[model samples]
Target chain A: MDIVILLYKGFTALDVVGPYEVLSRLPNAVVKFVAKQKGIIESEYSSMKMVATHTLEEIENADILMIPGSTTAFLNVVKDAETLHHVQRIDATTQWTISVCSGAVLLAAAGLLKGKAATTHWGLLDMLSKFGANPVAERYIQHGKIITAAGVSAGIDMALYLTKAVAGEAYAKMVQLIIEYYPEPPINISDFSAVPKEVEEAARAFFKKEMMKMNIAAAAMN
Target chain B: MDIVILLYKGFTALDVVGPYEVLSRLPNAVVKFVAKQKGIIESEYSSMKMVATHTLEEIENADILMIPGSTTAFLNVVKDAETLHHVQRIDATTQWTISVCSGAVLLAAAGLLKGKAATTHWGLLDMLSKFGANPVAERYIQHGKIITAAGVSAGIDMALYLTKAVAGEAYAKMVQLIIEYYPEPPINISDFSAVPKEVEEAARAFFKKEMMKMNIAAAAMN
Candidate 1:
């Protein structure tokens, strides 16, 4: 299976890396990172870089199409005409289209999630509707060929589900065993009330501030 | 807080990114990726690269020191005198010395984990004994300044714990909420019996075969 992951400057590394750890190890799975050009693509945090071996023009179709969202960079990416064009083109050719976190925004921008239920990072869930998507807060949503995962960490769960969809439950379980993905998060994140209201407010405030910064940057870029 | 993460060729990307996503958001936190030399460090699967901003010699101490392990490349890293010496040297001044997966082997090689309860990838748990580490098959272990996390995915949990330790519980909870780290894995990876025997056998065998290949490659490099 040719699993091509889209690489954009300032993309979140974990969104790609989490799924890569699971899908790359699949039997005969060929995972490729593709961007506008073949070179080093630095993630948004300025902490990590991923090599894109192929350009968007080089690969037109994939068995699995993965689009990872950046914490702040996704703002700029959605406005890139070439990128959305490629996403729209690839979505037409791919068997499965998967988006992580705010990556659903890009998919929605490409008109793939129009009149479909999808999920994105809880903090940025409101933005999905601006692109005409009915946002659902879930770990992952599988509606036909489209699979959208929530937040940065949900990519692993989404990928495992994708594995089960493509291969079988046994194969997906094998991949899970290899990663040893027994999660023990320190706090309950699913239920909003589980976290203190003040802390949650601070978290939302922080996200809003970052998104504002990203919006300004995106406006300048465009 | 100055958090320095060691980056070497063949290191796992998520191992560093997971911790980074948590720690970088800390109030007044500065995270740096350092290597033997400042350059692009490709991850184990060859899917991603991280830019090491500081040379190991330039950064002598860290508030928090993080080391990520490779499935095969860690063998070479454990034997690399400069890396072990740097690890030992930095550990002397750091408040917390942490290792993820086989990274504990590197820490053990640095003489930091002797008689310490450390953890690593389950497939190579027995090898921890060679480094004089009391291998514990747990998600994360904290023995004084030394902290070890099991496997690839466990790094996130370890980092959150570190966040709570460094910051307060409320701050850590805020960071957790920001990431929306709601994990819902498909299978139980903690208990070996939770999975099928043949799948477990395949996982073990696969790790063994890859280690053998890595062993050969390390021999050639040395």
Candidate 2:
């Protein structure tokens, strides 16, 4: 299976790597990181670099077309017509079209999620409506072949679901065992609304500062 | 804070990326990917290449020194004198020395886990005792300045625990929310032994075949 993961500058590492780590383990799975151009792609943090092995134009088809979201860079990619055209082209041949976090935004922007229910990162969940996509508050929602996960870490769960679909219950269990996917989070968050206002505000401010820092860095690079 | 992540050939991607995605969000965190020599570090699966920004010789100290594990390659790294020497040197300066999966094997091999209770991948848990470290079946165990997490996915939980320690509860909660870390696994395995015998065997065989394939590719490269 040719699993093509679309990459772009300033993409979030875990958004891609979370699912890549799981999906890459499937039997006979050939994973490719495809970008606008094949070369080094630095993450939004600018601390890690992953090599994109293929270009968007080079990978004509894929069994799985994965779109990973970024912190703020997703906004730019959503507005880029050429990237969306490539996404549409790749989706035409995919057995499964997957999105993680704000990646659903890209899919919605490409007109694939029009009138369909999808989900993304909590912060950007409502933003899907702007693209004619109904944002669901679930972990993931599948509309035929397109599966959209909630956010960054949710991709792992989404990929496991995909694995069971393609592989088997037994095989998926084995893969889960191999990764030791038993999650024991030290803290529990039952409700996001219940979180302290100060904490939520601080989190928002932190991301805003980070996006500004990344923008400054990107501007410097240009 | 200088957060140094040691990278090497044949290491598992998620074992490192899981913790990295969480820890990199810590306030004022400076994350660096270091290898024996600074360049492209191919994962065990050979599907991805992560650039190691710094060389082992160049980094003098780190506030948090993270050691990620590999599959069969951990055995080779555990036996490498120079690598162990570098790990020891780095550990001497770290406020927290952390390991994920068989990464504990590397820490134990470096004598950092001597007579200490630690955790690693379930498949390799017993091997820790051989290095004079007690192997616990828990998700993670912390001893003074050292923390060892159970398998690949467990590192995400372990890192959250560390995030709380460094940045406090509210900040860690913010990080968790940013990552949307509310996990909902599609399936659950309450007991490893209860899994069908065939499924367990298949998983083991799959890993063995993959390791051999990697060995063959490594030989070809040589």
Candidate 2, which segments miss by more than 4 Å at Cα? A191-194, A211-222, B190-197, B211-222
Residues A151-208, candidate 2: write the lDDT tens digits.
Answer: 7999999999999999988888898888888788777865566567887777677667
Write down the lDDT that model 2 would get: 0.88
- Give the per-residue lDDT digits (tens) of candidate 1, residues A108-219: 9888998889999877777788788899988899889999999888999999988888888888887787777878886556555577889978876776677677556323
Which sections of candidate 1 miss by over 4 Å? Answer: A215-222, B188-190, B215-222
- Residue B26 deviation, candidate 1, in Å? 1.9
Give the range of the ten consecutive residues with the poorest summed lDDT in model 2 chain A.
A213-222
TM (chain A), candidate 1: 0.93
Question: Against the true structure, what is each candidate's TM-score?
Answer: 0.94, 0.94
Docking class of 1: medium
Chain A TM-score compared with the true chain A, each model in order: 0.93, 0.92
lDDT by residue for model 1 (B45-151), tens: 77566689899999967899999987788888877998889988988999998988888889988888889999988777877888898998888999998889988
